[model samples]
Target chain A: MILKTNNLCKQYQHKDGLVDALNHVSFEVNEGDFVTITGASGSGKTTLLLSLAGLIHATSGEIRIKDFDVVNASDRKLSDFRRKHIGFVMQSFALIPYLTAIENVMLPLAISKFKKEQKYQKALALLKLVDLENRKNHLPSELSAGQQQRVAIARALVNSPTLILADEPTGNLDPSLSTDILNLLKKINKEEKITILMVTHSPLAAEFGNRKINLHNGCIN
Target chain B: MNIRKLVWLEFKQHKSQLISGLLAITLGIAVIVGIRSISVVSEKAVAVNLDNLGANILVLPQASNVDNYYAADIDAPTMPEEYVDRIVSSNLEGVDNLSPKLTRRVKVGTENVVLTGILPKNEITSKPMWQQSGLLGNDLKASCAPSNAVNQSNGYEDEKLQRKVIDSLGADECLLGSTISRKLKLVDGSSVIILGETFKVSRVLNETGTVDDDRIFIHLHKAQELLKIPNQVSAIEIMGCCNAISDGLLSKLRNVLPDTRITTIGQIVATQIQTNKMMNKVSLIFLIIIIFVGGISIGNFMWANINERRKEIGMLRMIGFNKATIYQMILAKAFVLGIIGGIIGYILGTAAGVWLGPELAGLPVQPIPSLILISLCISIGVSLLGSILPAYLAGRIDPFKNMQEV
Candidate 1:
């Protein structure tokens, strides 16, 4: 198994009362598995992904990713683990607007001890994998929506992370572009044997995954 | 691909937003440097002037007009030269050294020059032990004497003319003033006739920017003989000890020479010192105000920058950059701004100081090299101090919260 969560719980303080964003959720994924989490808005789909990534603290949980304890680890250890083992793709294609496509792909390796030439080569290769080699020098603002999303995907894979956590990767694209991005993710998952845990509201995107998990009111059904 | 490159790209992209802050720091530093430079040069000029006025006390004949200390000997009525012997015998306090002058206007090659007779140090020392020991002894070496007090006491560019009061002058040799030399077209060793007597020019005195520059200095006995004034001098210059001057030296000298007009240059020096002190205080106050205003401007600029880059910061955090790195990136931008501002401010400030020093402080100003480092340090210090809080807040930004925002 590459990922596991035992009775994960996340709560929020609201003016009305305490709200449960995640309630006793538990799941596991084997290596190279493509798991898609589906839920309506406010169903804790994003919260669960954030909790697993250690971006937010969970009320109570046991999340183990390849023997690294996500919930109990210190901030430094969690950051290092994320840098070395995980790649995150956001819905809005969180690319730094000032950086070019190749530079955006190179962002995760900024803190690495890699030489400048080595880093550039690695980022160029990732951009080529995502079919953006010719457009590597184009800034994010100059790129189309699909091209921007492809650049974000290239950034996510630059570190050769073991797991890719994509939150609504195709949410901002057209139906045709969305299909292209989903097919690219599927290709990366099968060819590189990298585990993918993605959250989506679209049934079409959820179909691409081999394992599907649906959530309603913070609980898995 | 590195933190440094990242900082460069980010700063270049958003530099437009920082223009106001950069300008504020630059202007503040420029004002401070300008004021300080003028103050420094003005004080130096004042000190040089005080040094040029070597003697503090001037004892002129009662019938002479004493409008200016430098020209007090010009057109002066004669007084009995026995007054020098009288003062020496009285053994008054603060009597360091005396240079009894007998000035007369004489024609030298169609040019009217003031021929002033000055008693040389050796001449004074040649007197009887009872008179010379009391005048040129330990008191002449005291800190109050201008020649012994400052390295540039005479403000002379020529090394040989550094001492305004020379030890001796040959009876047939004379020292020409800079103006007299240039006007008469004479050089050292040139012979000039003054009142039908030929005298060799031993040396030309450097320009003092005073009446002394238009005079000729020869032995007192020679001047007295040429002018036919025996036992009479125009004025007696007394180097009163600074400590005794405060202890009623002027009143004591007045009591001894009841028929002579006694004056001291202390009043003029005091007024100039007061003006310099006021300039120093004004500059200090301006520095404080600029720091306060400039610091706020920088802090506001950094805070706004942090707020605008919330999503970008969040993205970096998601990519595994730690809080410390985030904090460092913000401060790095501020540091760069400070360096740029400091250099430009220093250049502008120096120019302004040199240009306006004469108008404001009535003295020529020169750039002080040490101020370059001082300005840079102050600029960097203010930049860092203003950005610390904003940088801390930037480090605390939550990736999840910021990324979730539209």
Candidate 2:
């Protein structure tokens, strides 16, 4: 397994009592697999996805990515883990408004010790792969919703992370744009042989992944 | 790719906030530099005044006033030359320069003038603001030519040959004040007979806007011979730096010379010191207020900036930037702004100081480099202090809440 969770649990404590956001979740995805996790609102989809990416730690149980215990990792190590092994695409596309498309694509490599020219070359090549090389110099505000999303995808792959976690990658896109984003992801998954775990509420969006897992009330169904 | 590049981009994008923040720091730095310049210029003015007046303290012989009043009113009472020797031998600390003045009212030609005798020595030239024109008398130069060459030049002489012959008085040469010079219609080359003796004029002195404008200066021994007063002086002019002349010193002199009364320049020095102290205090208060006010303004601006950029911060975290990186970027922005503000403020303030110092204090000032460096640090330090809280806030932004909001 490229990623695994053994009865992982995460709880948020409220004034009343403990509220379980993720309770005893267990799942595994093999290498090169594209898995879409589908759920309704408040179904622990984001919490599970965040925990799997080590963006948040599990309250109990174990989370292993490439056999490294992410749940017990230090904050620095967790950040390094994210930098070197995982890429994330958020619902809003989350492009830095001040940076050009190419600069945004170069963000993940910002903390890396890569040479400036080398990082720029990698960013330019990724923008090319996303088919937005002509618009690389444009800012996020100047780009359309679809073009911005394409830039975000280029950013996620900048560090050449083995796994990509996309949270509602098409939530703000129109139907045609959503189809384009999904096809782009499928191409990256198949051509680059990079694993992808996507979280979405749309059934049509889940259909693009190689396998689909439905979540209800914080558990796999 | 580094924090600096990111900070520059952020600053470029947020022009309004950045400008306001930098302006505050610049104002604070300007105040610091301006105040420092003012202090330096004021000190220079005080020093110049002290120089012009000859000494921090004056010692006058106590002639009889039925009520301990004006010594200048007395006619015959004179302090013996022994007092001068006694004071010098007493080994008083901090006495840098001393000149004994012996005055006699004598008829020279048709005018009755106060003829003050001064030793033509280094002590005479040490007095600041004393100006003269023309040459030392040819007779005096023949007697003391090479030994007094440097001093003749000290009297503001412009001509090389004239300077070599000026103010190097022997026993008979004299300097006349502007009043005496104009009254007698005398240029520097004129001569006047006094008490059956004659002396050539060495210079026609400039008007000092002081009592020195009314007197004529002659060599000490010559005045003694003319007045028939051997080994007696009217007063002593002693000048040293601050704290050198005080009441305690006067008391010691009185004990040594019980027959005579003594007066010191305590009032003038005290007043100058108090004035300097008060000015420095006011400047210090202004400096403190500027720093705090500027810091608060920058702090508020940074807080608002962090609040508006929460989503951007979350995006950075999601893209794998650690909390440290986020914090560094925020502080880098503040630091760069502080540096820019400091340099601009330094330039403007120094320019103002150089222009305004002489205009206000009537003294030229060149602010030291150390003062500029200190002001720069203060400006940058205030910026760093103001941005700490906001940078911390930026580092602690919750990606989960940010995602939900988006």
Candidate 3:
């Protein structure tokens, strides 16, 4: 299993009482698998996705990524692991507005100890993969939402991670653009052999994943 | 990207803010440098004048009302002559040379002249002290040879009138200053009747380029006799071996010769110098406040910049930037700003200081180490302080929350 969680549970506490976001959730995904998690609003899909991403910790659970026990990792080690292994794409297409599309795509390589020339070549290749070569110098504000999502995808692939976690990868796109984004993901999985874990509420978006799981009342079924 | 590129990108985006910060720092540094130059120049002026005064100390009798060592009204304190004998035998501490002089105001015709009587040995020994331009010493022969035009000319001849008058008076006469001799038309060896005694003109003395240029010098005993003052002297001039010994020796002289008032030259210069030092301190304090103001301004601007770039930081972290990379980016920006601002501020400040230094000092001034040190310190200090807050703010930006907003 490339990623595994044992009896994972996440609780959000309000002033009144405990709100169970995820309850006794256990899951596993093998190397090279394309998986999609589907759920309604507040149905624990995001909470599960975040817990798997190691961004937020589960209240009671064990998370293991590859051979490393991510649940037991120190904050510093977790940050380092996040930089080295994990790539995340947010629903809002979190491209740095101040940076151009090329720079945004280069962000992951910039952080790692990659050589400058090699990092730039890799970033340019990734941008070309996303068909954003002409729009490399344009900032996020200058790009359409679909273009921004493409830039974010290029950024996510820059680090050459074993697993890519995307939240609502095409939730904001029109039907035609959504299919194009899905086709891009399918191409990346088939050609690059990168594992994909996506969280989405749209059934059509979930159809792109190789396997789809439904989260209902905090339980993945 | 790398820290250098990160800083360069930030600098390009925020050029105007950096320029504004540098402007404030430049103004503060300029003020400090200008004030520092003035104080340095004034000190140099005081040092030059002190050099011209032969020594840095002046010793007068306790009851004498002399303004300075050369003043004519100075009276020898009517104390027992044992005081002089004791001063001579004890080798007064801090005193390199102890020369006693007698000064009297006497009338030469209608003009009032101050007369000074000096012991030949002491006077000749003190010649090295008066070696500034125009003052002649026994060792340095006069440039022109004495002419015999006076002995060969008639009194009635206009060309020879001065020579004839000089011849009428023999040697052992008066050596009139140029101003006095010119006004009286007296030549070398001219005899002048004064106080019922016929005094012959001797070699006319050259100008000392001092107040002494207005006075005449005669044999000490002759001056005492001419003024009809016997056994009584005027002022005592004391030259200290070094400034370190001056204060202690002056106090000792005042103590031993209680009847004689002792004035050290350091005391005279100290009062004004002390005032100048206090003013300098005030200016230094003001400069410190100004530097801090610049620092606070820069700090505020940088902090706001960090806040404005929060979403960008979030995007970087989400894409795979670790905290260390973010830290390096922030710190690199701050360091670049510091170095650039410090160098630019230093250059602008130095230029302004050099241009305005003399105007502030009330005279022309030369650059000194103290001024440069002050400017550099202010520049570096303000730059560091200004950058600290921004660096911290940049570090604290949470990628998750900022990304959520985006």
Candidate 4:
């Protein structure tokens, strides 16, 4: 297993009263599994993905990535764990605008233990895997939305993360482009044997995963 | 790997903001350094004047061959040397320096030079010029220094060289004034035939831009022996009397040495310190205002950088960047901007200082490395101080919230 969660919960103190974003979620993902989380806009699929990624604090419960408890770790330690173990792909392709495509991929490796040349070589191979070798030097603005998403995906895998938490990876793309991205993720999952946890609201997006779960009223079904 | 690239990307993307911040520091530092340099240089000029030049009062034997208006001046009947001790014992707090001298015109190699014999005791000739002359003894050392007294004396002495020079001069060595030195083409450690004997040229006084420049200075005992007057001084020069106190000292000297003719040189000293203090007050006020504005510029720019890059920061956090690295990156940018501004300010400030010192403050201060370093620290310090709040905000940014904001 690459990730495990037990009764994990997250709450927000809104003016409307305490609202549960993640309510007693329990789940596990085996190595190399592609798990797609589906729900309505505010049904807590994104919140669960965030909790699993250690991007936000969970109100209560256990989140273990390969048996390392994340909830109790210090903020610094959590960042380290996230940097070394998890990768995130966002909806709008949050690639730094000033960096080129390959440089975007190298961002995760900036503080890595790899030497400079090794980091470069690793990033190069990932760019090739994402089929962006020719476009490596292009800025995000110069690339199409599809190409930018590819760069974003390559960035996510730069650290060879144990779990890739993608929040709406294809939401900004057309159906064909979305299908292409899903197929690439599936290909990466099978070939690299990496676990994938993705959140989305689209039924078509849900079909790309081997296992699908839905969230309603902050509870999993 | 590629940490510099990340920093460069951020700076490159926000060049205009960085430049404006840099301008603020530059302007602040430029004015501060320019005015400061003026004050520093002017103070040095004052010190040099106090160190090397005339006393306020001259006490001469009354009506003694009266400062020869036409031909070579003859030595007057000596003022009682006991009068030196009398004025000293009177506990006059205003007296800064006092030296007795026997003055006469002498023929040195066919050139008539005003030879003033001054007691080169450490206390008598001592008004600490920048350089220590072996002939002037410790009187040429820095005055009224602080605990960094050692620092004040550093490079001012070469004891061995001075000792060798002083050792050769007891009654035989003589110091050449700039005019005499140039006229005679004399160099230090050269043999000069004076008073029918070979005297070693010990050191030369710098050009004084006054009548002293045309004079040759020899030991008091040497001049007395040349004049066949044993144990008598022609006059006493009293230091520390500005125009403010010249009248009172003249009366006191006339009473103490009843047969002496007292005169005041009226060395006003220009009150350079007061003038410099006023200039300094103005500079400080301007500096504070400029620095505050520069600091705010840096702070505002940094905060905006954080705000604009929320998603980028969040992305970085997701990829394993920690709070410390985030803070460091932001602060490092500010620091680099500060350093750049400091360097530019230092160059421009030094130029302004050199140009304006003599014109406005009438003080010539050479730019030294220490002053340059101080200016660098000030500009950079202002930039860094401005980054604290922005760095805090950068560090505290929540990755998930950052993603949501975008």
What are the chain B TM-scores of all models? 0.54, 0.59, 0.56, 0.52
| Regions more than 4 Å wrong, model 3 | B20-23, B37-39, B46-54, B58-263, B347-361, B364-377, B402-406
The local lDDT score (0 to 100) that residue A94 gets in candidate 2 is 88
TM-score of chain B of 1: 0.54
lDDT of 2 by residue, B1-406 (tens): 6567888888889998778777877877877787677676675455434433444445666654323222252244677766765666565654444556687777778898878887765434533322121111122121111123222323333221222224457676788878888888888888877678777888887775544556777887788777888988877655443434432665666776777666555556676667667778877786788678878888898989888888888778766778888888878877887788888888777777888877876656575577667766877788888889888888888755545632
How well does model 1 score by local distance difference test? 0.84
lDDT of 2 by residue, A111-205 (tens): 78999999999999999999999998999999999999999999989888889999999999999999999999999999999999999999999
C-alpha lDDT of residue B238 in model 3: 53
Candidate 4 residue pairs in backbone clash: A83-B320, B126-B139
Which residues of candidate 2, in runs, are more than 4 Å off?
B57-118, B122-238, B241-264, B347-372
How well is each residue in B216-332 modelled by candidate 3, as lDDT tens digits?
556555666766766656665554433233236667776667767766555545743574576679677967776688788777767777787877776565555666667677666
lDDT of 1 by residue, A1-221 (tens): 99999999999999999999999999999999999999998898999899998999989989999988999988778888888898988889999999999999999999998989999999999999999999999999999999999999999999999999999999989999999999999999999999999999999999999999999999999
Instruction: Note the Cα lDDT for every prediction shown.
Output: 0.84, 0.75, 0.66, 0.74
Candidate 1: tens digits of C-alpha lDDT, residues B1-406? 8888999998888867768878888988898889888877765555445434567789999988888887889879999888988888888866766778999888898999999988766777778953554666432343343333232443444322332357778888888889989999999999999888999998988787878889898888898899999888999987666546655888899999999999888674465557666877887786677677777788899999889898889888877888888888989988988898788889999999999988997766888889889789878878888889899999888877533621
Q: What is the clash tally of candidate 1?
A: 0
Looking at model 1, residue B91 earns an lDDT score of 85
Candidate 4 chain A has its poorest 10 consecutive residues by lDDT at A47-56
| Pairs clashing within candidate 3 | B61-B261, B62-B260, B62-B261, B166-B189, B166-B190, B190-B201
Interface RMSD of 4: 2.1
True lDDT of residue B17, candidate 3: 77
Where does candidate 1 stray beyond 4 Å?
B55-119, B122-279, B402-406
Q: By TM-score, who's the top model here? A: 2
Which wins on DockQ, candidate 1 or candidate 4? 4
Consecutive 10-residue window with the lowest summed lDDT within model 4 chain B:
B142-151
